[model samples]
Target chain A: QKEVEQDPGPLSVPEGAIVSLNCTYSNSAFQYFMWYRQYSRKGPELLMYTYSSGNKEDGRFTAQVDKSSKYISLFIRDSQPSDSATYLCACKINTGTASKLTFGTGTRLQVTL
Target chain B: SAVISQKPSRDICQRGTSLTIQCQVDSQVTMMFWYRQQPGQSLTLIATANQGSEATYESGFVIDKFPISRPNLTFSTLTVSNMSPEDSSIYLCSVDGGSDTQYFGPGTRLTVL
Candidate 1:
């Protein structure tokens, strides 16, 4: 099984609506979690970051991590058309040495007007 | 966040040819990584490029297939050798000094047709 699993969602929602995206993992050793946004032809942009299991809020975006369930979430309030992109959840595992970030299958989001 | 600049933003290469993608960071970092994102798939780690040392490849990835070079702390290169149609994908480079928070580069979109 893959270390991280995320839905490749063509999740469509209307503008001004709230959006919730999630990912689940099997590795209990993961210590850090992050959410990245990517445009059609650009790189993945860092949106939110959380270490351990907690909730971190930045602007209209919130990131939640549940270490007990190995689940992570990204919530966006008041979505916009420009918000349409791919959302990627990454987990970092520090094996007492160099750390590596394991990524999940990105979820494609489309916000309509 | 670091400003990461990648060269040859997009390329169309012929099968059996090799292309080297370059990533440059404005700030020096100790951790550099190379990843491949196939169509509709999650990002798969190719290798970790450590300055002044041979890159460490992940399972199912080899140095021969995707040779990586990190001659310094601010720059790294990943070469896709003997490319095939299956090799066409977006190749991304990321870096993080010690924070689990990683910053990604504007990926190089490669088309092997």
Candidate 2:
């Protein structure tokens, strides 16, 4: 099985709607969780980051992590057309020596007027 | 967040040719990573480039296919050898400054045909 799994969703939403993006991981050693937003033909930008199992809120976006369930989520309020992009979940682990990041298949979101 | 500059932002090259993408960071970092993002897919790590040593590649990637060079802390290069149509993707470089949080480059869009 892959280390991280995410739904490949081409989710379409209307403006002002709420959007939820999620990912699940099989590794228990993951400690740092992150969500990235990527527009077409550009690099992925960091959206939200969380350490361990907790919830972090940044403006209109919120990130939640469940270490017991090995799941993480990103919630966006009042979605806009500018919010249309691919959302990716990534996990980082430091094995006490070296650290690396593993990312999931991105979820595509489109907010229409 | 560190500013990253990548050369040859977008290029269309013939198959069997090689393309070297350069990544430069504003600040020196301990570890740098190379990633590949195919069309409509999430990013996949190619290798970890550390100065004064050979690059460490991931499971499905190899040194010959994606040769990496980290001559210094602020600069790195990833060369796609004998590019194929399957190699056409957006290549990104990242740096982790001991905080476990990574910042990405603008990315090099390679279109192999």
Best by lDDT: 1
- Model 2 residue A14 CA deviation (Å) reads 1.5
Question: Per-residue CA lDDT of candidate 2, range B1-101, in tens?
Answer: 88898999999999999999999999988788999988756688899898999999999998888899999989999999998999989999988856667
Q: Return the TM-score for chain B, candidate 2.
A: 0.96
- TM-score, candidate 2, is 0.95
Using TM-score as the measure, the top candidate is 1
Give DockQ per model, in order.
0.80, 0.68
Pairs with steric clashes in candidate 1: none
Looking at model 2, give its docking quality level. medium
Q: Write the per-residue lDDT of candidate 2 for residues A1-113, one digit (tens) a residue.
A: 88999998999999999999999999988899989998877888888788868889998999999999999999999999999999999998876445677999899999999
Candidate 1: misplaced stretches above 4 Å? none
Worst 10 residues of 2 chain A by lDDT: A92-101
Clashes of each: 0, 0
lDDT of 1 by residue, B4-68 (tens): 99988999999999999999999999889898988888888888888988899999998899998
